[model samples]
Target: MTLRRGACLLMGFALLGGCNLSLPLQGRAPQEVSHRTSSFEPLAEAPQSEILSNLIQRRSVIAEDSALGDVARVALSSGARPSEAKLRTAKLRAEAENKNWLPTIGPVVSLTSLGDVLASLVVDQVLFDHGRKKAEREFAWADVEVAAVTLSQDMNDRVFTALSLYVTALRGQEKAQVGDRAMRQMRAFNRIVAGRVTGGVSNLGDLRMVEDKTQSILSMRDTAKDEATAALAELEAMTGTRFDGQPVAALAGLHDDGGAPLEVLKADAEAKRSVAQATIQRASLLPGLNASGTVSNSGSSATLEASGETGIGLGTGGKLKAIEASKETARRQVAEAQEDAARKQSRLEQRIASQQRQQAEAQRLAQQGQETYRLFQAQFRAGQRSVLEVVNVYEQSVRRALEGVDAKYDVILAQLELARDMGLLADGDAI
Candidate 1:
């Protein structure tokens, strides 16, 4: 063909194919993607308000002017997590895949019969692909959803870690305070025993026992101090912030209300992804139709093409059926994930309730022990009870007090655990 004739033919082909060419092509999903249906009620792409609102509200309450808030904000701002990077990558892939429906322009080089190279520019658009392109787009979007959930999971986990460390440090400090008070009381007992022994009113053995108790309390105080220092250092390292006197915020209203857990969302995303992949695999076993327009130095051509696997066998039918079955499997997996999350949340709630009860009981016993210790001290002063008996009562009171502290922190840790599992420790937008 003449150069001018080829140019006109190419222009005609271009105009014909331009009908499907849409601008602002990136980041647009195909409207009729199959995986997007009512079956997936809590769609992976759905707004996270329901899922994260309770936690977000809780954060609003406690995250300001609190240690937990500082730790979370600092940790989140420290750097991009691996999951965040993955989400970014998935977003890019989805954007690229969103434009998959658009025409592709590329150079084609071939050897002619005269042993000469021919160069042409080809523009190809999918006229029909058994919905393969749609499946691809769905897959890419699903991947993005999964990555988003992962990012949420990772961020929540990070915040949970920092908060847990803070809680640990707090627990250690409280224990150390308890130990210090106990040590002071024990030292007073030791002084009394020493004075009695020197006056021959008490034996040396009594003074030795009192000294041992004092040393034990001192050891406990030192251990607790060490723990607090270690936990504080680690928390500082993770959040890149120095934690001075951050108060522990009450986690009373941080429980999950009713929403999809991160695990369920991740499963839903994976299910849609699996179904989309199955569709693509099934399409691959079949054929795809494409329209192509080529402009070359020597000629111009327009053609419709159908392409598929280079080889086909009887097993192709079985493969296609297996691919179809995988869709059901993916759906079942999502249901399983939901069940698992429900069971886990129930267990965590039960644990929190149990810890709260234990804490209350411990505080009650601790108060009663304090009254008993006061009564014993009065008896000892009146010469009705021995120093040993008074000392034992004091020890019991201290033990009960320590138990109350432990139980209180246990509840906090359990609540934090529940929040982490629910993906509610960090705000969804923050993730």
Candidate 2:
């Protein structure tokens, strides 16, 4: 029997080793991926109005459409041609110029007919001005820049809105949680009061008061639920996805470190804006280069007739002038982009500072609430306080706790907003 037991124990040890028991065990209870446990969880799905605002500012439907429309206008106004059209036009013009200079080489065709063919080619080539081509390229480039900037701005704004919604929702959810706890406590007190009245230890008045307070808590809870629902809907609309009713992930605790310097960011944006403007201005002064070839055959005799020309040509006219005109426009765009960046930076700093102050005030209030609760508890325990007094103190404590959570969320939101304004946040950081 002892031998058998030893063998069984050895087998168990082997099985345990095979099971990789050395791996660290997860501390949380088994749960679905959708289920989350955090005071800030509900707010995770909450819509951030700020992120929406930012998205609207950066990449709204109107802005995207406008950018596209501008690109189209640039293409049209600049007379930018498709690659094939440009190649054909270049070839035709080059052939025309060549015919104008070089005598037609073909079978013994009439000199009068050759002269007519050469004249036609020259007319076609001369009709397309060099300035027009240059202007088209410049306009195309400007349109590209406009589209890029609009897209970037749109993405930035959406992220900001998502972050704002997330934080606000989290604040509201935390308040709801506090209210839930308060209601539970109030219900328990109501039960206790009922038992006391039944046992003749408490009067009818006490029971009725406790009941009324419980009803009041329920009312507050309903209001919070409504607010949370609205926030969730808003969040869903922005993200264009559904959340499984999970809470938002908690942000790291606040640190005393200040936000990034707005002046530095403004300077960076200004520098880039200047570069963009320079590119636009330079586009106007430069002439474009193109090469083309063409083959044509005209029958002047029963035997045969053939002519061809291949060469390079430079043309300049209306388009180049338009590009020159756009230099001032490009400079203005750079100035506007720089000013906007600067304004954003300043606003971010001010918002962070303001949120930090609010958080400090909230912490103070939470501390005061705790102190008051302790005093009230002591008095109630000594039978020096009524049940109503105890309930009020508890409710106050709950409110204070909710306020503290909200303040923390606000700080997180402010940080997120600052990050967004700096273009640090990505799509994955939407929450």
Q: Pick the candidate with the highest lDDT.
A: 1
Question: In candidate 2, what are the lDDT values of residues 171-234, reduced to their tens digit?
Answer: 6677788788888888889888889899998999989988887887788777777777787677
Whole-model lDDT for model 1 versus the true structure? 0.77
What is the C-alpha local distance difference test score of each model?
A: 0.77, 0.49
- Top candidate by TM-score: 1
- The TM-score values for the models, in the order shown, are 0.87, 0.51
Give lDDT tens digits, candidate 1, residues 1-431: 55676566555555554554444435766666554222112334323423223323323223545667777778777855887677678777877776676677889899999999999888777776678878897888788778777777777788888888888889889989999889878988988989999999999888887787778778878988898899999988776788874557448576445557789988988998999999999888888777787888877778988888544688998998999999999999999999999999899889989989999999999999999999999999999999988988888898899899889989988988888887777655444
Alpha-carbon shift of residue 14 in model 2 (angstroms)? 82
RMSD of 1: 5.8
Q: How far in Å is the alpha carbon of 123 misplaced in model 2?
A: 7.7
